[model samples]
Target chain A: SAVISQKPSRDICQRGTSLTIQCQVDSQVTMMFWYRQQPGQSLTLIATANQGSEATYESGFVIDKFPISRPNLTFSTLTVSNMSPEDSSIYLCSVGQGTEKLFFGSGTQLSVL
Target chain B: AQTVTQSQPEMSVQEAETVTLSCTYDTSESDYYLFWYKQPPSRQMILVIRQEAYKQQNATENRFSVNFQKAAKSFSLKISDSQLGDAAMYFCAYRRVNSGYALNFGKGTSLLVTP
Candidate 1:
């Protein structure tokens, strides 16, 4: 198991602005993923952040809207660009290391006004 | 594409009682994995249990256990002796074995526990 922490547990943002959420893991991990959970909906994968390369965005997601940076095995960041009311949701980061289990962060609640 | 389904939108259980949450998935692959995750009011997703498709026996974790029906493509979670902390949204997820693909999650079931 890994201890994951995210910055800005909850925040209110203005439309058209961008907010960057940071994810830091206690141990090194090979794969880190970002997900978005809309109100009353299931979680959707946003992107996968791997060190030393560009992040892989899912089919319905684009890097321009959710840019990710993975400088090392233990740290990653995701930025939500051009925030809108529709972007009001919970953004969670998860890490999969040597085991098949995945551990998640508490998530950052973002509300775009 | 793999899809997971949780039909029960909401359920309630009395304290010290047991409840089961149903989950079904559609997948063409023979080898895959299933998981149950719990999200409380704090919005922290925690792993409750996991089951591998190839495994014949069900997965169990203390008070939480899974009745895995591979032939039916169903994996259900049974919580025994429910507590207030057990009240939350429970999600079922599926992942491809040996693939680095992300998990496919179902719309969660909100469980309310009354003392």
Candidate 2:
């Protein structure tokens, strides 16, 4: 089991601003992912943050909008840039060890006005 | 690509009664895992139960259990002796074995437990 701490539990931002959410894991993990959960919708994978390499993003999501940084095995950050009201959602960080189950952070709830 | 579907958007159950939440998934991979996660009003996601595709026996945890029909690609959760605390939004997710472990989640089923 892994313990994850996500900062800025809730934040209100204006349009065109950027907000970076950080996730810190208790253990070193090889696979880390970022996800977005919109109101009344399911979770959608945003990207896979690879250590020391460019993050692999899912279709419909771009690096310019949701840039990710994986400095090491235990930490990663997701930045939502040029925010819009549509971008108001809960962002989650997840970690997995090999074939084990994925664990998620509490999530950062963002509200763009 | 894999997809999970929870057909029921909302369900109601009386306390101490039994209720089942249906989940179906589409996947080409033979080896994978299915999970049921519960998210209360607090917004913390908790793992309720899990079932491996290769396992024939259903997985049970206390009052929570799963009915896994691999051939039908259906996985349903059954909560017996349901308590008031069981009220929450439940999500069904899938992960392919040997994959990066990124989960494809269902839209979720909101359970309401009435006393």
Candidate 3:
């Protein structure tokens, strides 16, 4: 089991601004993923953050909009740049070991006005 | 690509009663995993139960259990003696085993426990 702490549990930001959400894990995980969830919607995978290598983003997502950095095994950060009203959503970080089950962080809620 | 579907948008159950949340998924791969996650008012996601595709028997955890139908590509979560704390949004997710891909999630079903 891994304990993930996400900072800025909830934040209200202005449009065009950027917000960086931090995720810290208690143990070294084999893989870490970032996800976004709109209000009342299912979770969407944003990117997969791996140590040493650059983050692998999913389709419809770009690095210029969402930049991710995994400095170490236990820490990672995701920045939502040039936020728009549509960018308002809850971002979550998840980690998986060898099991199929993945543990998630509490999530960071960002509201763009 | 994998996709998950949860037919019911909202469901209600009386306190201490049993409730089942239905879910179905489409995947080309034969080996995969299914999971049920709970999200409370706080919006924190929590795992409720999980089932491996190869496992023939159902998976049970405490009062929570799953009915995994591999042939039908259906996985449902059953909560026995539902409590107030059990009232929340439930999501069904699917992922391929050993694929290292992101999980595919359903829209979710909101469960409301009535007094």
Global local distance difference test of model 1: 0.95
Query: What residue pairs are clashing in model 1?
Result: none
Q: For model 3, what is the C-alpha lDDT against the true structure?
A: 0.93
lDDT of 3 by residue, B13-111 (tens): 999999999999999888888999999988878988888898999999999999999999999999999999999999999998876847899999999
How do the residues B11-62 of candidate 1 rate in per-residue lDDT, one tens digit apiece?
Answer: 9999999999999999999999999999999999999999889999999999
Worst 10 residues of 2 chain B by lDDT: B41-50
Question: Number of the top candidate by DockQ?
Answer: 1
Candidate 1 deviant stretches above 4 angstroms = none
DockQ of 3: 0.72
Docking class of 3: medium
Query: Which prediction has more favorable lDDT, 1 or 3?
Result: 1
lDDT of 1 by residue, A10-99 (tens): 999999999999999999999999999999999999999989999999899998999999999999999999999999999999999656
Q: For residues A1-113, what per-residue lDDT tens digits would candidate 3 score against the true structure?
A: 78999998999999999999999999998789999999889999999998999999999999999999998999999999999999999999999865677888999999999
Candidate 3 Cα outliers beyond 4 Å, as residue runs: none
By TM-score, how accurate is candidate 3?
0.98
Chain B: TM-scores of all predictions: 0.97, 0.98, 0.97
